[model samples]
Target: MKEKVLILGGTEFVGKLLVETLISDQSKELYLFNRGKTNPHLFPNINKIIGDRETDDIQKIQAHKWDYIIDFSSYYPASLQRTLDHVNRDLKKYIYISTISVYDFNKYDRASSIKEDFPIVDCSPEEAIDQTMKTYGKKKAACEAVLKESSWLNSVILRPSIIFGIDDPTDRFYYWLRKIKKETKAIVPNDGTDQISLTYANDLVAIILKGISGDIQNGAYNCITHDSISFNELLETIKKSTDSNCEFYHKDNEELRAQEVFLPLNFISNLYYNNDKIKEATNLSFTTYENAITAMVDHFEKEEWKKCMIEIDDEKLIS
Candidate 1:
């Protein structure tokens, strides 16, 4: 029988991209679970389950026996525990969508390249249950530990850098772009020297699916492009791509830090990844940073990027 794959949080950014890729591969059956809202059209042809992970109505999830589960939405420790209990024990692979925030944010000054072995935040049991607010990274680190303890399945944990593309509503990078577009002088933090990691949506999805299909084992991997670009270079490239001649007032990292202007995009790394494993495993090369930023600018100019604009309803989650 073909492997049955279930994707939780199928409507969000990475989840939506994963569904698109899975549907194109005819060898597998795809199922999506969410709250029956958001970009519902993205998964028009797949089986869907509507359930809230927080509320614990696992009935929609318990009915199916999936060979692989791509859990893109598991955040809280309770959700992670619930997922382990609900999935079939015989599942071949359990892929978890995680973040680089699992690593220490303060360590960027020390290392140019952050490996998967980097230390993540520590969380207590109480912190895991209330995982929504400031304790997000701590909870995710705890959840990773939880899945690693499971002896039943081969768990693939992916720690991706700042993910940006057309459908991303987080406004992480777009805020800068919008500021550049509207103002005569764009203010950038840290003299644009602070190194940052960026991954295109398509590139991230490719890595996740390739890891799953190849039966990559229960270890963790950092998903990123081979190259690291400074924030100044990123903006310059975008301006060139868009033909915008706006002047940029560069501020050193210290100044930006002093002013506390949301200068740096979070979940950053110094362009770290030993893609040797992924290359040997799947021979997939990620999209280049310059090309990725250019593509993002094109999407913005074409207005195709608005798909990721966080709707007012969804904005409440972060606010």
Candidate 2:
């Protein structure tokens, strides 16, 4: 029998790519549950259920038994609790796409990169209720808590760093991509020394599939590339990938802050991770920054890159 797979939010970026990935396998039955507001007609042949998770509409999802459940949109703990109340028993495996932001970036000294066991944000029940970007990490931590506390559920929680690729909604990575492709001069921070980790959307999808196949161990894993790169190296890679002749101007963070201009991909402190656990468990190689950026550049070239370009007002910077 073919495996049954259900994705909570399959219309956008990661979820959409995952759906595409699963569709190629003839041995899998796919179902997508979403609000029906985004690209509803993308996958015509697959099962699509329309409902809202925040209201009484979630009942649409309660009627199915899934061999694997990939939740790409669960944010609030209470909301997740509602879904768990309904499908926890029938779900063979739950894969949550969490963020590396769950690590308490401000409290810890991350000179050696963060590990899976590092402390997460401790938010009260009341605080986790809010779903703003400020509380995003705390909220995800709370959701992870719900999965960890569940006695019957076998869950794989993937905490990825910055996830970037085609169809990204946030446009964080897209900012730099467009900047390099458009402008001759780009503003950078701290002479591009601050290091950061990133997970390509396709790599993340592969890991999820591996987890579903029982090739990866259960529990939480820091899902990023095995290595981290500096901002300069990242920009250079982007430049090479896009074949752009943009010259980078390294600016001091304090000066940029004074000018109300924050450079994309510039972190206050390095946010690298120790991803040996994930690599060893999955035994899959990750895409290098050069290759990943090249792929994204190729994607943008095929479409109108300007439509998805992130607006960065160059005038706001201190020239």
Candidate 3:
């Protein structure tokens, strides 16, 4: 009999990619659970359980046990604890998709290089939900705390950088790609010297699947590319990839931030990760920044990236 793997929030962006990777394994039984929306027809033959996670329709999940559970859709820390409480303790591994934003980006006084053991969000919300601030990252951080405190199954927490791909809806890099598509010149923020990291969905999926079958890291790992590409380097790659003869007009960070358009452009100077431990543990080569960006551009061209963008008017699906 083949081993079994379950993925929560399986029909979404990262969950969809992870399902594809696991299905190719052939030695494992794959299962995906979601609200039966967004590409529900994509995996017709696969086992899919439908229910709303926000509510308590967890009966479908309780019926089965999996060798591994990879969560990609969880945003609330309490929700994660609920799922773990329902799962079997003998499970192989539990992989959580987290964000590098857990690190206090505002705390610039700390060292440039942060390890997996670095601090993360652990605060309670004051008033209205602030997803833009510590709400999302801090919720994820609190989820990590739950896993660490558990003794039954091994857990792997992955903090990925900005993720972009063909079906990407984040608009993280797509914003720039769209801009470059229209004009020959674009305005960049803040001297364009800050280093920003990019994590390709394919590369991240690869590592997550490999981790499930291999030894457990039993902790958090920063899932970013090996190289640190600057804002200028990113632009150049786009120019070279698209063969566009575009010129870059620059603006200061303060200006962009004041406009609120530059909030996502959170540049972490010296934003490189120590992947030696991950590489040695998994025996996998980290994806290069150039290759990662190239993949995004390739996917963008194929999808006509402009059509899939989530408009500001339909603000609900902005993630």
- Name the top lDDT candidate: 2
What lDDT would candidate 1 get against the real structure?
0.72
Best by TM-score: 2
Instruction: Extract clashing residue pairs from model 1.
Output: 167-308, 190-252, 190-253, 191-251, 191-252
lDDT of each: 0.72, 0.84, 0.71
TM-score of each: 0.86, 0.94, 0.87
- Give the candidates in order of TM-score, highest first: 2, 3, 1
lDDT of 1 by residue, 59-101 (tens): 5688988888888887887778877888888888888988777
* lDDT-based ranking: 2, 1, 3
lDDT of 3: 0.71
What's model 2's TM-score?
0.94
In model 3, the Cα lDDT at residue 64 comes to: 83
Residue pairs with backbone atoms closer than 3 Å in model 3 (clashes): 190-251
Clashes of each: 5, 0, 1
